[model samples]
Target: MKAPAISLLAGLLFGAGLAVSGMADPARVRAFLDLFGAWDPMLAFVMAGALMPMTIAWLVQQRMPRPIACEAFDLPGTGLLDAKLLLGAILFGIGWGIGGLCPGPALADLAIAPSEAGIFVVAMLAGMTAHRITRG
Candidate 1:
């Protein structure tokens, strides 16, 4: 119960940050990726801002036995590079580049622009399903 509530609160804060940072806007993200064209550096700033807190959290996690809301940290164990990881990363990059809407931003955009965001979210879900089916 506590873990779920904490997760929900964290998600809400993340979504709010995305919205406030203009990261939920596909055009803004697209512009950031357009290095040779009308490039925008706002995303870099947002990334830096996000990185700071995450870095601190990771450092804190190292000193703590477990999270306050959970028995374990639930962090990923693997740091190994593999074909599957590479392929998934490539696919994710392709999708992000083409649509300018990654999962977080796309999910956040759903409330502001349902039609566009819905299409992206549905496609993303389909990709996730395909990956799961193929993995097994």
Candidate 2:
């Protein structure tokens, strides 16, 4: 019960932050990716702002035995640089560069402007489904 509530609250807060920060805007994100022409630095600043708290959380997490809402941290166990990881990174980079709306912002944008985000969301789901089927 507590975990679910905390998860929901955390998700809502993250979505709200993305929306307020204009990270939910695809055009804005695309502009940020653009380097040679009309590049935007706002996203860089937003990412830097986000990294601050995350850095502190990581430091705190290292000292803690258990998470506040969970028995233990469910973090990734490996730091291995293998084919699967490299392939996934490439795929993610391609998607992010092309769509300019990654999962987080896309999900929030669905609520903010469904019409604009609908295609990307649908495509994203289809990709996920395809991955599941192929992975099996």
TM per prediction: 0.94, 0.92
Looking at model 2, how many pairs of residues clash?
Answer: 0
How far out, in Å, is residue 124 in model 2?
0.6
Give the Cα-based TM-score of candidate 1 against the true structure: 0.94
Clashing pairs in 1: none
* Alpha-carbon shift of residue 115 in model 1 (angstroms): 0.9
Best by TM-score: 1
Q: Candidate 1 lDDT, tens digit per residue, 1-136?
A: 9889998999999899999999999999999999999999999999988888899988998999878987787777868998888988999988998999999999999989999999999999999898789885
Give Cα distance to truth, residue 77, candidate 1, Å.
1.7
